[model samples]
Target: SEQTNKHLYLFEVLVKNIDINRNLLNDYEKDLVIKNPIRVRIIFSDFYDVEIDEVKDCKSIHLPEPEQVKCHSKMSRTATKEKNGKEKPKQPKQKQKVPEEMMYVKKTSLHSQKAGFSCLFPMEPMEMLEKLKTSSLYFLIFSNMGEDEAKKIIGQAKVDVRKNFIDSVQYASATGEFPTTANLTTSCKIENVFKEVSGRIEVYVRLSCFGKFIMSMFNMLYNERNPANKKTDEEEKKAETTS
Candidate 1:
């Protein structure tokens, strides 16, 4: 009875972004895990990204969960005069965007851990370790990038990546930190937007090709505290009764 209060180890997760472009999805190229307590947010990039009819334009997917994301944005530095007051041309600042046009949100969440991580997003470390031996896992990812760029990224990337099916992806930018305003140091920023294919048929396809095998680990010993789960088989019942 005391064990039912415990929670299972959640690993599988899915993150979905509304009105996101095919290019800006970093989740596509990396080996991200989908652990427990996952959250997913869907954003709308301007009115343009929204669909007129809910049937085709609605953005949703049943993908694996993404791992805990430690989002970090450093202060975008600008060109400045040194202590000598020498004019230093600004380093082409990696443009920070506060793109209003593409306002969107991403949805992320976690699920039950069923199989080995190697089977899902196998990479170097995951492969070397036997699937059952290791508790580690990796997940596949999808992007809103154009077919050409998505294809190229998938082609060059070691892991699996791709666009959704029959989907015509459109290119648009959400409003964010423009990196320039009245010569004042532009505060770097970001935005929200969805994606669509330009034209033709683009069926949503999932590829289980590759990824980075960060580690081979076992579920923490403390995770399986629930007596109900621990006693899923009958031998445990006898042990429990004897105890």
Candidate 2:
């Protein structure tokens, strides 16, 4: 399947007080490393705003599948036969990597001494839209900060009608066009706040314009099949009204 440069939608996500352990020494007293842990949950749905019940009870969303992946041959073809009429030994075939749904989380800015987060979905619109519906998306209780910091943030943040108001700085990264602002409404919470935390934690949620994706796909297919149907600026208006 052919792909275009246009992104399905853009998201702006950020985390604060991300540097949890500012002054921790290693076991050998050689280097400072992050020892405290953070946990995050991301939720996606068709509602304009998600609810606390939704995030906690919802199952992980299914990602789209590849349309036309090319499987490569590991070894080059050998000659039909050797001079003595025996086939030459061929190199062993290598395994191909299976494609998986992946998202990248990048730190975009440093707040005071804290760091902010960014995430991107780098797949095509067709594959991306297959499993998605239009509307609300939520990144819940996500933190680059430590467990204590994550707890504080989630606690201070206010939520009304299944929405959380993020008073701290956060926004979506720029896409091909301008990035849209997130309407602060939806349920969000850090997973396992009471339990001990450990390891690298990152989360992402995206709300895409499914209607636009449908229109774009229709236009692309229609234009490709009937190139002659394309009209000039003047004729386009006439065709629109007549059709």
Candidate 3:
């Protein structure tokens, strides 16, 4: 049966060696880590609204070849430039508007080799839960250990989850103000480091946060770069030429 209107959380883990030139590591350091390290990316997402289940059998999933994380925002900025000797007119920049409400998770101290890291979700419990139900969160764990070594270490690691009700009605009695937000944090760590792999390895981690919510609504197709839009524009140009 297809799953819909359901709340789901799945963690996607990837393991790969770090690229010396691409990563922030020196030649000697890169050489050391290359023999003993694995880069990891943990992608978390809410599959409640997805039509197809992405992670049906996630437990025994195999890691694919490593891929570099591109900065989409930067790519968008660069793609708007002129091409084919065509110069686009510059329009006046509009003032950016600030949003009324915002939520985020803050990491106090995060590292690759370390299994346990702290995450702080700054928002009300209900609000944060809603966000989780509608958004996808990513955690990048970089390691200086080889893929095999890193996997073994991660297999024995422990993850601890805790919730802190910062802003609550009862707590307001002592603090004189009602708490409006809650902090949800999790600590993860890999214990029992293997001795086979040595040297100071560095891991680069990236987290992707996506907000996708569906409340009684269906899918939305963005036409910004759709071929239909382009076809219409071309048709209009042809008509103009004929007229």
Candidate 4:
């Protein structure tokens, strides 16, 4: 029932707007896009492994808010200081990692209203779905749902939303022919492959390359920020001291 809800709500939402949000494009955006428009990301993040057990109160939804696109317009990524109040290291790397923060889809594009939307870009890749898959996340963990053509589609669509919404979007077709459902399936797989290796997207190939509805995997707590979900490090440390 929860999975059904997510499919209905959050996933469908991202499918529609991630490609283009009307609010992000104004007369100014529309005007500049005609000339030197491009997408901008205010946030840069590192990936870390998030176990299903470690996940906290990150908001899960069946659909994305069309309005959140506007809210993020004023959003800026501030590099948080370490708990010790020290600067973070530059070029940190791990053999494997999950994302440090729950990624928000925001992009600022320099393109036009006619060319289409302007908004914050998705900041990172690989760690989102790749983490989910790599860790084999089990949020009620259903499986063998009868030949999931939808699974791959849902997974891949999120990547498109992240890339296209964040960067730039352009549409084209090859050899001037209508592609088919099978074609779409193949496209999803291909995109996943490209994205996995380089964390880069092949958007020109993705425009009409896949499914009608995007997959939204919204359900469950996401981060540790909510008071309900949070246990401050100091409290934990104090407990350790008493114990």
Candidate 5:
């Protein structure tokens, strides 16, 4: 059965955090301290040939303010300044925390048509694996929605599909123990699976297979609705009978 041979790849992308650089904001925005609601737009590219009919290409989500933390760098610089005309020795570099106003956090799933489920990618398992190697996801952050609903871009980030996803699946296929889940943390620098504009993004990914019986039923209904598919199926059935 063709349906039995095909595999459905389901992907769920949960965006966790976005930390924008303070320098990226203009003088007016910096003083206001990001009071406007933050919005994120997500796009998955170079992956599935066909997305679910209900899945939207540009999925947007609103983010709440992240937990605040004092800026360590600013404090350190101030503390280390010359006192009594004596220069203070440089100390070890301290990890800088993103300012509260510049950080946004929202645990929302992207590309999902339902509460917990995302769009299904119907294809051969091998083909899906190959495609996953080159797939990518893009994130666009926006703030300050105007009266016309036009969003101002703050920054952008890109993530590669192969990081924790494809490698785990490949290992599972070889070892026959598929975990069907992976986690990725984006960095401040723009690289594979990293964030850009000095921001961070964390994502939890889930993958699952669709049942064969359900796929068969879907195909049957689709063939019934489309004359081309119906004609092809009938011709195949006739050929099978003659053979």
Candidate 6:
């Protein structure tokens, strides 16, 4: 059976590994020993006129101060080499740990209505994919909220959805591969999608689609099996009867 009101595409964006270049900052900003909170905004643009905006609070994520690594002197290196009779291999530096709050997750959905929904007929997956190819994602970074509560733009980045996600699905579909299911319940993750930004902002985006039928069945089964939901429904019914 055909299902209605299901999203053709769903994207989950995870923003992390955000490193702001202090050298890129203005002299006034660089002089400050302590900087203000940094804020991140995500925007998803499709073929439609409307763009989805996901804005996060300034204080939500706290960027940690950069670590200072001490350099070994030549004398120390020579002494170590002489003691061992050979130069020691360099140890790899460990990656910095990102805070839980610093990682932001945003979900965006593209529906058939946005592509041109019709009451008489359902939209096809191919048509939806065609429309999705033109979509793109935008990332904007800001530093230091002013007294008037305005964001100071620092850097920005853009990513094409087709290159990052849609094209891969199309290829998988054309090849009759098991990677993509019949219902298009497939997902792909992309890292470092941002480009042409002043500072480095690492991001991961996961694109997926679940047919309406599958989602509807899952919801129905979950409602039937959950006792807490049944109790709430019964309570609501009793309250209505009493009224």
3 or 6: which has the higher lDDT? 6
- Among all windows of 10 consecutive residues in model 1, the one with the lowest summed lDDT is 165-174
TM-score of every prediction relative to native: 0.19, 0.25, 0.24, 0.16, 0.51, 0.44
lDDT of 6: 0.42
Give candidate 6 misplaced runs (Cα > 4 Å). Answer: 1-10, 31-34, 46-131, 144-147, 168-197, 216-243
Worst 10 residues of 3 by lDDT: 69-78
- Residues 31-139 of candidate 3 have per-residue lDDT tens digits of 5533443333343333211111112112222222213222110111112347776766554243222222211111112222222121222222244344444444333
Candidate number with greatest lDDT:
5
lDDT of 5 by residue, 22-114 (tens): 655567765433545555556665643221111122122232221212111122232345767776855534433433222223223321111
- Model 2, range 1-243, lDDT digits (tens) per residue? 233333444333322222222223224221212222223233444312221111111122111211211121112344457789998765434433322222122222221111122233444444444323332344343333433443322212222311221211012222333333333323333222433222122222223322234434655777678766544433765877999
The clash count of every prediction, one per candidate, is: 51, 3, 13, 28, 0, 0
lDDT of 6 by residue, 110-202 (tens): 100000010111234566566667566666655545567665666666655665456655654454322332212122222222333355555
Error of 2 at 52 (Å): 21
- For residues 3-32, write the lDDT of model 1, one tens digit per residue: 322211111211222222335435533322
Best by TM-score: 5
lDDT digits (tens) for residues 103-173 of candidate 4: 22223222111011112222112223243233311111111112432211111222223343222111111
- C-alpha positional error of residue 84 in candidate 6 after TM-score superposition, expressed in Å: 43
Error of 3 at 220 (Å): 9.5
Q: All models: lDDT?
A: 0.23, 0.30, 0.29, 0.24, 0.48, 0.42
lDDT of 5 at 84: 75
Runs off by more than 4 Å, candidate 3 = 1-4, 7-36, 41-155, 162-183, 186-188, 193-215, 219-243
The CA-based lDDT of model 5 is what? 0.48
Segments of candidate 2 deviating more than 4 angstroms: 1-12, 16-39, 46-218, 222-243
Candidate 6 matches the true fold with a TM-score of 0.44
